[model samples]
Structure formats: structure tokens, C-alpha cells
Target chain A: MLLVILELVGIAVFAASGALAAVRARLDVFGVTVLALATALGGGVIRDVLLGVHPPTSLTKWPYLLVPALTGLLVFSFHPQVARLRRAVQLLDAIGLGLFVTGGTSTALALGAPPYTACLIGMTTGIGGGAMRDVLLREIPLVLRREIYAVAALLGCLVVAGGSVLGLPEGPVALAGSALVVAVRLLALWRRWNAPVAHGLDA
Target chain B: MLLVILELVGIAVFAASGALAAVRARLDVFGVTVLALATALGGGVIRDVLLGVHPPTSLTKWPYLLVPALTGLLVFSFHPQVARLRRAVQLLDAIGLGLFVTGGTSTALALGAPPYTACLIGMTTGIGGGAMRDVLLREIPLVLRREIYAVAALLGCLVVAGGSVLGLPEGPVALAGSALVVAVRLLALWRRWNAPVAHGLDA
Candidate 1:
């Protein structure tokens, strides 16, 4: 129950972010909706596909579709007010990041991925949606360029994978892992810490 | 036997296009390799994933991995001369588009996707790699803006799907579909034909 809720929240936040980005880019209503759907659902779809799950929830379920679709439309309709709440959105995004990474890791484990591969897939799940949104917007992916986003997800995934490997119960370990990711992401944002750029050739 | 050969040729051409784009973007060798791999293998990976196939051929098969990796390196090493072969590459790309669309549709059909769904997936498979490359390169997806790329793929897929629905043989249907895609793509290029631009709002 809790996991389902968390997933919905994550999808809604991601959808809002994508819708806002489309608005910022001066996209039309259709564009906003498409970008939002891609941003909210792209990661999970990729993860499910990798795990060999057919007709992923993103494609088949009602709540999963409705939440993101509503969020995107709402964001599009009230973009000015939504944009003003940037800090709040960032905080929600941090929370979303936490939930998605932990959820992704657990799901990969459930699907019988090797621990290390699960860790990688978890990170991919966390970043995939935003990457799609950015790409469609004709921007270099923020995950590849932004501050500590993927690193935070990777670290969280590692913790989950490690716990799973050690025979720890999944529920508590996932909660702890998500908390850690949220903490690290928030702290990074608060401190303005970023991984060092890889010299002039990184681009 | 013939299908395997055609698939390899398509992958090589897509890889070369990606690597050439990377070079044109002034990306480093690593970036060139990554882009090339994504372009060559991305579509198939997506198609396989949607079909609930695990550890997609791109991840597990040696030939699938090697051809694109080598293509990227070779292109990076001899970009200037290769870039000069633009016309030849375009012709190859048209052939690749044909193969991918036909292959994708067939695979989807085999996996039990509905005829229309298979058609859409086929078009997706034909364009997904180039979309990834263009996105990574921070350019608008060429398929979304340029000549009749997606349209040609869609039309080809429709032929394949229509044939299947009519209980036609798969082999000849696919061959005919692929030929149609290639012909349309090449004719569009040769005749300087393009879809009319949406006024102002397409961006």
C-alpha cells in the first residue's frame, strides 16, 4: 500500500516537472502532455521492459495513467503559479528521487536481476524519465550534466542491493535506503555540492 | 540467414551515422562510441523489451555489440573522409530504415502485439536509434522535423500489418514492406520532398 502511494507521488512529481519544462520551452498543449507523459512513465516503462514485464503498469493501469495525466494538465493550466513554487517542487522531486530509486532496486531484485545489475537498473530507472524529457526538449540530459542526481540514486541503489545481498528484510532496508537518498539529495542541494567536471572534454 | 545479414547491415549503417554525428558534434571518442552504440542497438533493445525479452541481444550477443563498437571507432578515426561519403551513407540509412521497420513489425507480430500496435512499434524501431542520437546531440529529432522518415516507416509497417491481417505469408510481406520503405525514403530525398511544417507551434 505504502509503496504504491510512493510510486504515484513520484510519478506525479515527475509529470509536473516535465509539464513545467514544456511550458518553459514554450511548447503547445499537446507537447506539454506528451513531455509530461514521457517524463513520468518513461523510467518505469524501461525498467519493466528490462525485467521482461509485458504491458507494464504505465501502459495498463488506470491510477498510474490518471495521476500523471492529471498532474500534467494541472501544471499546464497553472504554470505561472506552479513555476513560482520552484523550491517546493525541488523538495518534492528529491523525495520522488528517493522513492523511485528504492522502488526500482526492490523491483529489480524481485524480478531476479543480479545484485550489481539491479543497482545499475535502479539508477537507470531513477534517471530515465528526465533523460527522455530533456532529450525531447533538445537539451543535454540533466542527469549527465546536473549536480549529484545520478550519484545519489546510485548510492541509494547500492545500499538496497547490499542489504538484499546480506539477507536483510526488504521492507526496512528499502525504507532506510530511500531515506538516505532523500537526505543526500537534499543536503547536496542545500550545500550546492556537485561532482567535479571532467575537464574540458566532458561534453 | 538473409534476415541476420540484413540486420547486421542496418546496425552498421546506423552506427556509422551516429558516430559521424558525434564527430560532427565535436564529441570525444567515448561519446562517439556511446552514441554509435545507442543508434545501432537502441531500437532493437526497445522492441525486445516491449516484447518482454530479457537481456536484449544488444546486451548479450557478441556480434551485436562488436559491429557497432568497431563502426564507432572506425568512424571516429576517419571522420573527415567518411563524412565526405554523405550520399552513400544516406542511401544506406534509407535501407536501414526499411529493414528496421519491417523487422520491428514482424517481431511485434510474433510477440502477439495487435496489428496496429505492431505497426506503431515498427515505426518506433525504425526511428528510435536516430532519435536517441539526435537527442544526445541536443538537436531536434530529425524524424520529427526532416523528410518523410517516420511517415515512410509507418506506411511500410501498414503494408506489413495489412498483409498479415489478410493471411499473407510473412516472408514476402516483410520483403515487400522493406522495399516500399526504402523506395519512399529514397524518393523523398531525391525529389527534395518534405512534409509541410506546422506553422510556428511545432517547436
Candidate 2:
């Protein structure tokens, strides 16, 4: 139940981000729907593929597709109202990222993936969809640049793994990891956090 | 031998298209490589997954990953010269699509897929990469609205199936199908053809 609720929340938040990004790119309704779908379900699709699960959730479930479309419509209809809630949107996005990372790690662990792989999955789960959406929108991926985004997800995964070793209850462990991620993201945003970029290609 | 040649030609054409599209979208070198990979290999990945093939070609072969990057660099360096040969690009793309459709259908048939399914697979094989590239680029799938794009593939598939029934030589049948598709595509382009947007969504 917790998983389902949090997953839906994450979808909604990501969908909003996707819609906003499409608007920034001057995309029409069709473009908006496609971007929202990528942002809302891309991470899950990648995780499922890596786990050898076929027909990932986005393709198998029509609701998963519809939810993003609805969110796109909402974003379009209430653009002005949403603009006024910029801080709220940022806070919700942080919460969504936290939940996604914890969910990815916990699910990978449950499925018997190793700690390192779980951490990678956790980070991907938080940011993969966003990265794909940005790439599709022809924008640089947020996680690969100056967002402090994927790092937060990585730290959340570490927290969860450590808590499990300490015999923490599953609920608290998940909650605590998620809280840490959210705190890091919010703090980073407040501080104008950024990753370093250099000239030319990297080794 | 034919299948391998056809697949290579299809990959090369799709890579060129991907590079051109990325450049038009104002993406840098890295972004062009990403688009090229998606455009040249995405359909095969989808087909392999649906057919339960593991470790999709893009992941299995370093060459498959590297070739697109090289193509991107080449295009980036010689874009002006390449752009002057746009007609040649279209002709190559048409030939590639015809061969890919036949190859895809024959493979599906050999794998015990029914005739109808085999034909559909053929069409998928021909246009799947471009569709995926457009989707990833946040554009309406080129196959979805482009002039007789899917139909051209479908015609080639039907010819292959029909030739088998008529006991025609495989080489002649394939040549005939390729010629037919190229003719149709050329005529469509000359006439400024397009598929009807049946749903009639508001602009």
C-alpha cells in the first residue's frame, strides 16, 4: 500500500516536471504527452528491463499512460496557478525523488540484487526517467549536471542498506532513507548547489 | 549474406537520419551520438525484446554502440556536404526500408510467426528505429504521419509473402519488392503525400 501510494505520487510529480519542460520547449499537446510519459515511467522501464522483466509497467498498463496524460492536461490548464506554486513544486519533486530512490533500492534488494547493483538501481530509479525525458526534449540531463540530484538518490540507497544491516524495521528504514534524500535535495536547491563541468571531453 | 547486408545498410541510413535530426535540434556532439544510437538500433532492440532475445544488440556488440558515434562525428564534420546530397539520402533510406522489411518478415516467418504477424514485424523492422528516434526526440513518430512510410514497408512485406506463394526466385522477389517500395516513396515525396490524421485532434 505504501509502495503503491508513493509510486503514484512520484508519477504525478514527474509528470508535472515533464509538462513544464515541454512547455519550455514550445511543444504541443502530443509532445507534452510523450514527455510526461517518459518522465513518469522511464526509470521503471529501465529497471524492469535490467531485471529481465518483459513489457515494463508503462507499456503493460494503460493507467500508467493515462495518469501522465491527465497530469499534462492539468499542467496546461493551470499553468498560471502552478507558476505561483514554484516552491511547492520543488518540494514535491524532492519528495518524489526520495521515494523513487528508496523504492528502487528496496525492490532490487527484495529481488536479490547485490548492494552495489542495488545502489545503482536506486540512483537510476530516481533520475532515469527525468534523464530520458530531458534527452528527448533536447536538454541536458539534470542528474549528469549541476543538480546534486543523482547523488541524493545514491545517499538514500546507502542509508537504506545500512539501516537494513542494523535491523531497522522496513517502514522506518524506507522512511528514513527517503527523508534523507529529500533533505539533501532541498538543502542543495536552497544553496544553489551544482556539479563541476570542464572544457572538452572527459576520460 | 543478404540479411546481413540489408541490416547494415538500414543501420547506416538510420544513423545518418538520426545525425541530421540531432543537428537540426541544435544538439552537441554527445547528443548527436545518443540520437544516432537510438535511431539506428531502437527498432531491433524492441523486436529482440518482444522475441525474448536477451542482451539486445546495442549492449552485446561494442561495434553497434561505436558505429553510431562515429557516424555522428562524420556527419558533424561534413554536414554541409551531406546536406547537399539530401536526395541521395532519401533514396538510400527507401532502399534500406525495403530490404529491412523483407528481412524482418522472413525472420519472423522462419521463427514460426503467422503470416499476418510476420508482415507486421516486417513493417516494424523497417520503421521502428525512426519511430523510436522521433519519440525520444519528443516529436510525433515519423512513421505515424509521414507519407506512405508504413505502407511502403507493408507493400514490401506483402511482395515477399506473395512471391513465396507464386514460387518466384527469392532474389528476384526481393529485388522486385525493393524497387516497388522505392518507386512508391519517390512518387509520394514528389506529390507531397501524407497520411490522414484520422482522429482529427485540434492543432
lDDT of 2 by residue, B42-87 (tens): 7777666644467775579776777767887888778888888999
Clash pairs (backbone) in predicted model 2:
none
Residue B11 accuracy (lDDT) in model 2 = 79
Question: Which candidate number would show the highest DockQ if scored against the true structure?
Answer: 1
Weakest ten-residue segment in model 1 chain B by summed lDDT: B194-203
Off by over 4 Å in 2: A193-203, B1-38, B46-52, B55-128, B131-203
Q: For candidate 2, lDDT tens digit of each residue in A1-203?
A: 86787888888899988877776665555456556767888788777767665445455555676787799778766665775799998998899899888988888877888877887888888889888777776667877786688788988999887766677887889999999999999999999988877767765
Candidate 1, which segments miss by more than 4 Å at Cα? A52-57, A60-66, A196-203, B1-45, B52-109, B114-123, B126-130, B142-203
Tell me each candidate's RMSD, in Å, in order: 6.7, 8.1
Prediction 2 global C-alpha lDDT: 0.77
Error of 1 at B182 (Å): 16
Question: All models, DockQ values?
Answer: 0.16, 0.09
